[model samples]
Target: MMNIKNYKEVSSLWIEYKSGLKYYILKKIKNEDLADELSHEVLMKIYKSCCSGNEIKNIRSWMYQIAHNTVIDHLKKENKFADEVTEILGVDKNNTYEDVEEFVEPLIKLLPEKYSAPLILSDIKGINQIEVSKKMNLSLTATKSRIQRARKLLKEKIIECSNLEINAKGNPISIEIKADCEPLQKNSRKNN
Candidate 1:
């Protein structure tokens, strides 16, 4: 439980950081009302986490990390919610890309850090190869090779998990993660 001083500190931090955090969220989400809502959600999440009695060293880093994940989750939910609405209204019939992404993200974690980090930075996070190389402290060529190897490994895992044969166009006939796959066991974090 937070003592009076700690509670005041948390409140002061929120007051100091709320506007900048809201602006960051607004820049990504591009909706004023939604950004405001998410900003409040961020503070609420931080408050809950703080009250839970976890020892937080470096509160700024902890808050920003939560902010980052919160934004990703909000964007994902926004997209998914839109898809759901469209599906219900019969506005779209194709779900192939979404389905593959749903499986691929989880599968990406099963890979070794060398393979996974590059792939995630370049492919998933949309960071450029050069930037990823710099970030990973690797030569550009090595980063490129790791990304390629990671994709190959991911493809093999996808095949083994989904039990599907790909067609000539390099598309899976069906993308489904098998329940008993190694990635599923390795990634124990339940999907929200």
Candidate 2:
């Protein structure tokens, strides 16, 4: 059982995990403002539960379970419950790589805008480099360079955040986030 007694420790955990939590919320709700609001609520709920002398066995899973329930409640309130259920049922569970991509997209959102913007436009959105260059108002060469740099930086961040082992080709061999590893920090990625 893990007990966090110090307020500072709690705040530090919040700082560390805020982005991942918000991303999880955003995945469920698909609304930025609502995700932010629900994330704050999740944080407050966790803090209160911890402070109330409850013994949390696995904090990360517990927090996510809470987040999941919160989303279900939100969906019910919005009367979108059936839609979400149908969507989930329609999804193919065998596409594990797609599952990882779903988790990874939110982590990518944590990267600094310069790196993230080009990466998102090029990789996630499937936009051509030339188009991304124009949208970013950078020369084609500079945009391509930034996109490459962003991929490198993003790969490093994913490895660091998840404590995953990478192959010679820089592909992750392990996708699980280590319990000891800190949850991903929010958009505080340094300027590169």
Candidate 3:
């Protein structure tokens, strides 16, 4: 339970940080309404954690970390929701991308960090390649090359581990796991 002093502190902190937090989220999300909503959510999370009696050593850092994670969670959920809507509406006939993504996600983890990190930031998280290059501290050319190589490696791994049925458009229609494919089996088990 929050004591009077702690409650006052939390309220004061909210007043001090709300606008800054909202701006931080807006920069990442590019939406005013969502930034306001997520900022309020951050305040509530701070209040709850404070009420639960966790001693936060650095309140500012903790608050910003929460705000950062909230933005990331929103982005991921937004992407997934769009995909779900597309599937539900039958807007895209080539909806097998999501199905393939399920199998590919684990395979990405098996890749080397250098290769996988670039691929994940650019492709999975949907960050712009230039932004990914900046984040990864790599030249744009290097980032693009790594992404291309990662795709090739992922394609090879998929082919090695499963038999993919392709349609006339060269899209994968179905994937059948090969017998005794230990890497994928282990990855699947680990994920589960």
User: Is 2 or 3 the stronger prediction by TM-score?
Assistant: 3
Return the clash pairs for model 2, or none.
none
Question: What is the Cα-based lDDT of residue 181 in candidate 1?
Answer: 83
Strongest candidate by TM-score: 3
- Report lDDT (Cα) of residue 93, candidate 3: 20
How many backbone collisions does model 3 have? 0
In terms of lDDT, the poorest run of 10 residues in model 3 is: 86-95
lDDT of 3: 0.72
Where does candidate 1 stray beyond 4 Å? Answer: 1-93, 165-168, 185-192
Error of 1 at 59 (Å): 50
Better by TM-score, candidate 3 or 1: 3
Q: By TM-score, highest first, what's the ranking? A: 3, 1, 2
Model 2 residue 160 CA deviation (Å) reads: 34
For model 2, state the Cα shift of residue 169 in Å: 44
What digit string (tens of lDDT, one per residue) describes model 1 on residues 38-138? Answer: 88889888777655655443454455555655776776776757565334323111223444566677888878988999999999999999999999999
